[model samples]
Target: MSIKNTIKNWVLCSALLAALPITVTAGNKAEIGVVKDFKVTSQLASRDQAVRMFEGEFFRDPYIYLGPDDYYYLTGTRRHHLSGGSKKDWTSEGVELWRSKDLSSWELLAVPRRLGDLSWVDGLKAHSDEVGKGNARVWAPEIHFINDKWVIVHTTSVRKAMLYVADKAEGPYVETELSTTIDHKHDPSFFHDDDGKVYLTHRVDTVVEMTPDFNELTDNEFKVKPANRKMGHEGLYLTKVNDRYVIFGTAWSTDKIGRGSYNMYYATATDIRGPYSDRRYMGRFLGHGTPFQDREGQWWTTAFQNGKTMDFNTITKAKGLEKKKYTVFKDGIYLVPLELTVKSDGDVFFTPLDSRLVQPGPEEVQKF
Candidate 1:
């Protein structure tokens, strides 16, 4: 089948599923109006299928930050509850540190810090409102353990991303006083390279060098967008496979809202900021995800299927992208195995596993 046809069929299946009458199982209550689609193929059935880590927790922009002690720390944008607040107000409400030695089980470590607690919250809010992108409220956050300190790089409704630091993973993290900044930044991604250098990818797929101290930016910044792409990049993610660096980011078509589509585009480079190859599309229905490695050194992606707010059929026709099979799953935290293959012609693409598994496991000594 042509790639376009595959994508078309996938979107149609999703629409059919959405049109079905909502059903409730005995004990599992569907949150956010979504029910888990249990009709997957037998080959995809997981051996250990009892994983549901995000149950009852707010879910959006799923991220698993691997800590220094070999534990996985998870967080996401919460549903907004503030009156007259933007969409991400809930994210700023407070952060709950979900810690686990494995992906299956999780426990909350109370490091709750509200957005109002940040000293610059008022100033940032005012600036974001002035810019007219108030909905960007606490959009996406990326946390890293750097230089023996826990650091969070997050963007608010404002035009720039801010840096916060604490002695341990749990905080009262204070904002880092920086001498340099990237204006109008969103979707902060912190990638620490194997050589001990850390790089940041933000709005527009721009990569910049950051000092290990997390105090300032170095004199380097460049957009890694492939010349063939029409839209800019957000939700920047980088991971090294073998000796090559795989860079991926989320992009949306701007023709219309819900009818529009979002997907991940990627390019490869040997160096962090590079002469990257042309862009290629991954699962057409995927958006705003991160590819992480487990303790076993296997590559897995924590990606969510985009919700029904917009459809992708029109976007595919408009964008001239290849027809590809769409895997329509419910929007939630998914743990899918990944296989990276370099095409005979030297093109690199990734194939994700069908089985969705959430492994279980716990909290140790407080790191921060």
Candidate 2:
């Protein structure tokens, strides 16, 4: 194709997208737009500034886990999936995974678990077309390497969660009996403690011990609430740092006030189930992002276009933000550099190293 014709095609495509609604709704709920192309007109951020990644895929609550084989595995909310953007996210047929040696380039590994893989999901689907059309949907899918096998955890639009076990990282994942135990679950996460205990979290704070085989949720279920406040609305995650337990959750910048910038907040505790300290800011517009480490041991947290993503300059400027587009890329995932700091008091906290991402915005309801 000639350069002139290629440019013409780009212009035509942009106009078509602009003519469409921001969200293609089904039933009565809105679903996040899926990715058909990862390419952008310009790089949202420089390589040195932030490790921004692109692919022909749409993702949310982005998760990347370092597997036992030493490869990084990634997954996310693929709600509408490949149904040409008509179906809703929760009704996604199943889970999709990708792998990479380095964060920049990724290869699609497999759609290991389709909606039909587990017969139980059918039992949960609403009798009516509550979700427009399609089976129960999956959200916030997570992959973990635990007990010498692969375990996948995800929540559904039906307000339940699932646990699947597979022999390989990418696999013909099978349903586990534990799925029946996790009811009213949302944004579930996995954690393997230093002493070898396996834990799963849901509803932003509630936790349950899991058997070593990842098949059963033991009788011990409890909540790990923060001392200062509830950890926002959804997208709860877990990790450990320096013998302390750190939990992260997503919420709007205006607290209970909705429709503001989606952001991340975290709290630390000495014990697994804790009376955690007050929540502190992780970064602006990083809601539901997964904090991870590259092969070089540098820390990074995932970020994506959720309503309005802020550039480094705009995220800190905090004036008339509502009027600003506050973003460039409308799809794909991002890696924001993070500094993990330990205070003299033995508390571990996170700070975004990207200058535009470091500070909380003016819309933040909490003082911290």
Best by TM-score: 2
Model 1 C-alpha lDDT versus the unseen true structure: 0.53
lDDT of 1 by residue, 1-368 (tens): 00001233223423422121111123221122222233332322352221233443346676777777888776665443222234423434444456666566566554334455556655655555665334224545666786678877666444456677788776768877761244555677777777888787776567788888777788877767554553333566776765667778665433122233445567777766666767655534455767766666555566654544223334323332222222234544665566668766555677555422111001101111
lDDT, candidate 2, 180-211, per-residue tens? 66665667888888788888877677788888
Scanning candidate 2 in windows of ten residues, the lowest lDDT window is 1-10
TM-score of 2: 0.79
TM-score for model 1? 0.69
Pairs in clash, predicted candidate 2: 79-89, 80-89, 90-137, 91-137, 93-115, 312-356
Q: What is the C-alpha lDDT of each candidate?
A: 0.53, 0.66
